[model samples]
Structures are given as structure tokens and as C-alpha cells.
Target: MRVNNFFICISGCLLLVGCAGTTKRPVAPVADASSVQRPVQQPSSTVTQPADKDKNIQIRAYEPSVPKAVAPVHSSAVTSLVAQAQLLESAGDLTAAVATIERALRIEPRNAHLWNQLAHLRFSQGRISPAADLAMKSMALAGGDIALKRDNWRLIARARRGAGDVAGARVADRKARMLH
Candidate 1:
């Protein structure tokens, strides 16, 4: 009796699922391929003419305007932090100075000047590789500031020299000179 009930339930569910997608509305018959009409393409009737000088309508290729480089501005908070960091450095507290600069960097990570200052601090602390790398980061963010990029190159040259890379130092020095 249980097996018969289960079969009836299964059959009823199958029937319901089969009827779920069906509608009582009649379906239209599909048109045959031969009965379908294609749209006719029209030919261009307009003629091209040169612009008249008297009409002041000269055809010219579009030229995009070049963007001007603007200087990066530091906020009041960043300036204060930089001053504090400078004082700490002057006081011979290198660790505190670095921490202060890092705090400022957290506030303005894209400031090229801050990155340069951090690189300068790192260089002073005898971290040659990191100093060079940080200087490069500063240069990347320096944008159109030729002076800042030159300073970064000078710092990188010093770092290379400190790391016993004389050739690299000279190359960096050359780059710095070229930016002059």
C-alpha cells in the first residue's frame, strides 16, 4: 500500500512539473525561410566637397590639448607633522622622526615631498637599499617637479655609492645632471 502511494505521488509531481511551463493560449506558426523579406540597403547620394575659404569651414583633424602639471599642495596637518619630524631629527631622535614622518605619510601617502623626506631620513640611518628604493618612489610621485626628481636622483646616487655600486652611482649622478 505504501509503494502504491509513493508511485502515485511521483506520478502526480511529474504531471505538475510538465504542466507548469504550458499556457492555454494558442501558439503562432513560424514563417518559412522563403516567405521572409530582407531589407534593401540604400546607396549614398551625397557628394563630398572641399570646404570653401570664404565660408571659413576648413576641415581639420582633432588635436587633444596637453595637460599642464600643477604643484602638490600640503595641508596644515601634514605641514605641522613635517615640522615636528624635522625637530625630532634635529634632536638626534631618528626613530621618533621616522615614526612621525610615517604618521604624516599615513595621512598623505601620495605627497612626493613626504616620500623624499622619508628617503632622506632612511639614507641618514645608513639603510642604503631602502633609501634608494624610497627615493625612486618619491621620484615616481614627483610628477612634473624636476627639482624634486633631481634631488631623488642625487639621493639614489649617494645610496648606490654607500652600497659599493660605483658604476650605478655614476649612472644615477648622470641622471640627476640631465634633469638640471
Candidate 2:
């Protein structure tokens, strides 16, 4: 009889622990689906156009648009300017050539070729001091081109000759000859 009572008590304790481990179901509030807003649909064929492409628009005519003030001068422009200046100088229009070179210089002031060309122009026009100054500037900026160095020496010689410095002219001439 005692064994039967013990078994009964053990069974009752196991059942109670098992029931305590379970969680109860929660009650949720109901929601109305009809109160939600649906997203609007966009057309599939919508196309975007640039604002500047309108035909029949009258743009107020002003002075023809100049290039951007700070745009870098391209190498092609520098080459063309050099060729044009050479042609003008050959045709005895030293003044125009000088002006053209000056314009190019404004675009690429650090260009050695432009500086050398300006020196040549000044030397041709009998502006000795300015020519020497330009030649020095060119030499300082020149890369490792032998022809450019030779031309620089020639400009220096011309400037020295114009200034009546025979020794200086001789020295420059010798340097130019060495480059050849």
C-alpha cells in the first residue's frame, strides 16, 4: 500500500512540471486590410529628354560664346600656333608673329617652345635685352631636346650681338655650334 501511494505522488509531480513548462497562446487584435493605401503605378514608356534639345526655342543672341577662360590649351593648338607664327615671321610680319606667340604664351606660359619663339621674334625686331631674357626663360623651362637647346643658344648669341657684347656673342655661338 505504501509503494502504491509513492508511485501516485511521483506521477502527480511529473504531470505538474510538464504543464508548467508549456506557454499559453496569445490573443492578437484584428486589423482591417481595406484601410491600407496601395502604391501608384508608373508608365512603362516614360522617356527623359535633355532641357537644351528643344527645337524652336529662341536663345538670346549674344557675342559668340568664347572658350572657357580656364580651359587648358591642347598640344594641337600649341603646335598650330607655333606653325602659324613661323609662317608669319617668314613672311616678314614679325609684329603679327610676336602677337600670335604672345597669345599662345597666355595659354601656356610655361612652354619652352613658346618662350623660345618669343625670344626669336624679339631678337629679329632688335629688342636685345628682352630677347636675352626670353631666351634664358626658355632655356630654364626646356626639356632635354638638343634642337631646342641649340635654338636657345642662337637666340642668346643674337641678343648678345645686338647688345654689342662680342665676347658673350662668341661664347653663345660656340655653344650653339657644339650642339650641332
* Stretches of model 1 off by over 4 angstroms after superposition: 1-72
lDDT per residue (tens digit) for residues 1-180 in model 1: 999999999999999999997879888999999999997544334344556755544344434443354455788898899999999999999889999999999999999999999999999999889999999999999988888898899999999999999999999999999874
Per-residue lDDT, model 2, residue 176, is 86
Candidate 2 residue 19 C-alpha distance from true site, Å: 74
Residue pairs in collision within model 1: none
Residue 125, candidate 1: Cα error in Å is 0.6
Question: Lowest-lDDT window of 10 residues in candidate 1?
Answer: 58-67
Model 1: how far residue 85 lies from native, Å: 0.4
Model 2 clash pairs are none
Tell me the lDDT of candidate 2. 0.81
Minimum summed lDDT over a 10-residue window in model 2 is located at: 64-73
What are the per-model numbers of colliding residue pairs?
Answer: 0, 0
